[model samples]
Target: MRTSSGAGELLVELNRDSGVPLHQQLESGIRTRIRAGLLRAETVMPSTRALAQNLGLSRGVVVEAYQQLVAEGYLVSRAGGKTQVADIAVVEPTIAAPAASGPPRIDFRYSRPDVSEFPRAAWLRSVRRVLNETPYRSLAYIDGRGTIELRTALSDYLNRVRGTAARPENMLICNGFAQGSRLLLQVLAAQGRTRLAVEDPSDNDLRDVAQAAGLEVVGVPMLETGIDVAALEQSGADVVLVTAAHQFPTGAVASAETRAALVAWATARDGLVIEDDYDAEYRYDREPIGAMQGLAPDRVAYAGTASKTLAPGLRLGWLILPSWLVEPMAQAKLMDDRGSPVFDQLAFADFVARGEFDRHLRRMRPRYRILRDTLVDRLAARIPELEPVGVSAGLHVMTWLPPDLGEDALREAALQRGLGVYGLAPYWVAGDGPAGLVFGYGSLRRKEVVEGIDLLADAIATIRG
Candidate 1:
């Protein structure tokens, strides 16, 4: 039915014979009107009695619908006053015009998994099992260290897969690696540890995390082997963050010598190391390297996430802190939103325990390796001049551009040609570095990877001209 109010025109259609309840139908219709901006802010709604009488329904039905709308913040009700649409911001609908442009047809941005490969059936089954079997006590406010069940599962999993010596008591589940890093920084800041040293050409977002927590961020130049341990020691910074297994963007695995030197540096300086073991599972070449945390568990605080393995939306990550930092980090976690959602933690534990996680990885590793190989092969065939720097491991590979080509110009040209490519300039904290591009193949299919590289070669040619 359609009705004109003092504020504006409100149209609501009701199907009496439909299986949907009348109140819910009414609620949905009104909500749609509000969202569509047909009903503007402070628009007065029709009186429930009048609406019910006009629709030939009981006054109670209209009242219930209006109450629901009010509760959902779509409508506001004052004390014994008329109900009106809430002052909510609504996006204006786009007009039916010619399509201007869209995002790149193929994206090479890093750190995202192929979401199409997510094990939906297995995850759903795990969620169902967790819901069915969990005790009522598991539903309440639990430890900020996360459920012991998940921590224990993670400890065992890490020990087996990544060679990290973790115990349930020393592990803390976090929202994600981002949150885990922030919590560690918070605890460090509390202890008056003000300076944080990060890999020079590292992920900028992580550097910002330490800076946001009031720590002075220093950049240690990345060497061919790994982060420059000698430069790090010379910089006099006590706390260092390293992506040891597969360095981001550069993909430089720290050599055994560098690893030993880093451990010695930490031990001698009485310092701590934050190990970001991100995306260490999908190695295409040799077997994946064990985490640096295994070398010196007392000095390293290891962080890992399911962002690359399952999906970033899961927001599930864990931290394995040294004995000294465990209590402080736990207290920081407690103050930072209590803890990650308990249901997800429990469900993930069940997923790991049932071997679904490992099976999923085993299935995905080969697929990802194929995609990576396809990317490498196509890039070599099409753009032989660009040296692919980091192709051994991780989701992405770094391609060093010809000295004549500017990274910014090439990236812009590639984008114009419907090829999404990221430049390496943003990853540097020292303000300058080698010009290159980071190409991630995790989310791209084989054909898409080939087509994207072809387009990229064309873009590079266009830029050179």
Candidate 2:
């Protein structure tokens, strides 16, 4: 253990033999103490004269260090010439950065759409049109349920595209699917719903959202097709959240029989089904599955977002709720940030109504499809032992790792090579799922996809020995 001299009342550590400057050492030592809360706010600090004399240092060195810290706002100098630790909030970090790797050069982690391909031109046009045509009073605190105009437009669009049964009166505009789910879950919890069932191996923040709304999160097993209805029934959950169209991470489209069973389950138990129609538009193999909300509108609350098709930065999403839950959901939303920004809602309303949203999706589907195909082909060529599961739809493919290859070892080795990829184990609700890696190619071009696979092979070779 290293020893430090106690200067005055404050014990600022310093090393004379170290190459670092005395003033710099003094500043850092004090700064660390302040941030660590040992030197708390309003605690008087020793004068530079006393500190320098006590540490056997020249007064000028202590003066320089204290002035620099004051300039940096870590210490406050008062009118009476008293220097004290400044009032600042600093969160202590819990995780350390990896020492063996540089920043990821080829990021393949999932959940984001290709931001480079976002329809900027059409979105700008829509915003300008809304600003010009819409009544100025519409910008005022209108309704907690969002502007009726946006809800109406989303209703028409989702109904036509996703086979959703939505109405403007029952729909609510949210900041994103996150806030929407939170609001709805709050409403559910208020109505005495205690438990929420989510599919195992889910990769999104839905479970966290449910828990925040005071509902116990239960994980039902996911089948090859979709969530296992039998397990969901046995999970003792009154509410369920599902990605009905295309399951995230694993691209499993729920079968017709499974869909029928889910509807039946909801009706029989008087349970609520929250349908997250995530990535419903980008189906490369066959027609995209329709929303399950059309079949059981009353039993299911359907949610859709502009996040995947447009951009996540927009923080725009909509929810189509049942008639009975609409009012309570609106009240919940009112309490939670007073119903998302009106300008964004109105602009998105105009975007959906103008057919530009449809145009954007049509263009992006092929681009993402090409990337998906490249990743699959490259993986097959480089790592044929790895089996690609659920590749028929969505922006990413979840590949099951071979029994011999551990996910954690491969992931770290891949990271050291500057290739970012996520293992499937963390997504498992109960830590009992097959080892896999989620390869998201939505943001990557075709050439990068090829190189990423090459890097993956090199990383695999490192851990294989």
Candidate 3:
């Protein structure tokens, strides 16, 4: 059999005194040799037992190292057949990054729901009703598509509030938008579409999710109006993901022309659109922008989450997809995690049916509106040099800084003054963007917003002077 393991010459050079773990060292050696073109495609590798004996190591250690490389696709094993180096063209799957090491010092990061505003009393009332009324058998492994009550409620809610044309049969309830996106990406990848074009200056977590499914993410430029369709046309992406309403961080509403252009492009290319209508409920500027899915229900996959309006802890998100994608996405959901909590889904359905959700949104909208107004006023009063972007809607604003005040220096200075802020640098694929900080006013008290800006002003002035 042809050999790929490079065990003949390289194993002799491994020193027992090396600080690295033996499994890791062995794993690295095999991968390096593959990349060096020393291991030809389909070259057979000895069994771990045989290689261990040849190298004077424990069989289990060699097995562990081989398994690691196999998991990463450096090696491939056919059932009841010899192991071999993976072809250069093979794609490897990746898992999500481990949770961030520790709690951020003071997180002013955007994308967080206002945890302070969760309607606990109403939710408890709804949960109590669901638990008491639900039949005992309803608790068994659910339909995987979601509870019937939720699917019905979601069907109505998306149409009434967000302008989506999806039916109960087309909706799938997952843990949240992250899980929904992952399942969709998995389906897309399974269909042989490897690259997804997503908006740059958007959420990194989405990019992480797509990449975790063994798909390449190409960054598409987003203009003040929306994603640059001209650039998107050039990208040759099979799927285009967009946040049309209230683009995150930069917060540009996709213009009507841009929105129409995207639909036409997708129609021409026979591609699909993933619409993340994130934070569509809290539009202070005008009537909410109707969902893009409404215009082309068969082509657009609409995703909405309660995380922005209610609470992230709820972990409730829904996807309204074209008819073709529904079952595949549902199966992927079952494989990922067997749907979200049934109790929460039932309670949320009750919340929506009772008009309590509308009441909650109505109450929170004005409260957040006041907070946003205060944030803008305070920043103007205290930090005259800083400019706020995308203040018309959503829960947060990006404060652009003058060139003399570098984002990193300003961020460190603010931390010293007991204020938390984030730089926009991490959000971009291309480096050194409009230097700014994202300020979230959702749960922040008026006094806190005022004081935070005061501290930020002092920090900026100190950095500049």
Candidate 4:
């Protein structure tokens, strides 16, 4: 029953006495041969009945194992042809390769926007209207501080929606939050404020951006309510960057008491608070949190972005500056990139002014609420060891892994199972503290989220075992 030495022939030996079940033994033997260069591409294996006869096992046992390998894309069969081993050359395992290539099979990573839900029809209509109605001068290199019409529209919108004291004149449109932070840090540093305070476990990219702009970043402890006020005072930082509406990664809303206290501290020290109101609109729990910039506009350099609301590829964001800093920030804008795309900004202005933007948000909020609940429910059902954090709002959840599963080991095992997960240790300043995973459900479908988390549970179980 064994093949002597044909170029396309393979030898799959099944051991019934290894204590491993016959089917599992066949599966492991085939996979190990594939990995060890024993089973080359285009090689054909003996038929299930032939192999079973050769190994003195029932035909059903060999067939069951062969079926599994085929289901996993490792083998192929034809109507009247031999079941050949699939081209193993093309099947480089996902975990064996670099992490940044394509989308992960089961991505538990964070900060993803659901592009499938963007208002395509409304947005296209706004773009067409902007080309028709906007004055020719508005399209030219006009105001370095962005278009006035857009700012005016935003003035009303922010006031109505977020309760921010936004004036058209005080707002400066820039590339996005990153640009706003870079310009603001440069301005503050020019005014002799080189050291700034940031949340301890804040976004690592934010920290990288701040440092890249030559500003020294100081760590301030972040609590469930907000940044620790006492810790802020002790850090001796003159400028503070905060995500007040909902803290990034953690999803903590700043408490009213802490907000007032922070304002008081800033006012006392003649300091400034840079508020990054990112992803505040998609609150699943209560009404949208009011902008912290509203409490004391002059003391708060409020930065807002459309990366989450609309799309990140748009690369559009705006900042409402304090009056005294408007011209300076505008000049900084001119120095930075000469301002964002004029047409896109005009189109966005028309989009927001025509009330299409708000409508899109309203439509998406319910869908996201369902997705969030599905993620929670699935993880709860499959992975009881995984505790879902940041359940209140935002596009993702940060689930803390239990202590038994070390973050590094679990991450590797997940990658092997074609799952993507971002560990929390990288975001911490200490770099060796509490570890967890950031699961982004925005771009994922409801069914995918459920299956993905279930797969994740299996991977974790394998690692634990």
Between which residue pairs do clashes occur in model 2? none
**Candidate 3 vs candidate 4: which has greater lDDT?**
3
Error of model 1, residue 131, in angstroms: 0.7
Tens digits of per-residue lDDT, candidate 4, 86-181, equal 775334434565657566676766767887777889888988888888778776786788988778888888999988999999998888787788
* Cα RMSD, model 2: 10.6
Q: Which ten residues in a row are the worst by lDDT in model 2?
A: 1-10
After superposing candidate 3 on the true structure, give the runs of residues whose Cα lies further than 4 Å from its correct spot: 1-107
lDDT: which is higher, 1 or 3?
A: 1
lDDT of 4: 0.82
Per-model clash counts, in order, read: 0, 0, 0, 0
Residues 171-218, candidate 3, lDDT per residue (tens digit)?
A: 999888888888899899889887899887877777878888888888
From the highest lDDT down, the ranking of the candidates is: 1, 2, 3, 4
Name the candidate that leads on lDDT: 1
Instruction: Choose the strongest candidate by TM-score.
Output: 1
Misplaced by over 4 Å in model 2 are 1-102
- Please write out the lDDT profile of model 1 over residues 84-190, one tens digit for every residue: 88877344566897678777889998887998999999999999998899999988888889999999999999999999999999999999998999889988888
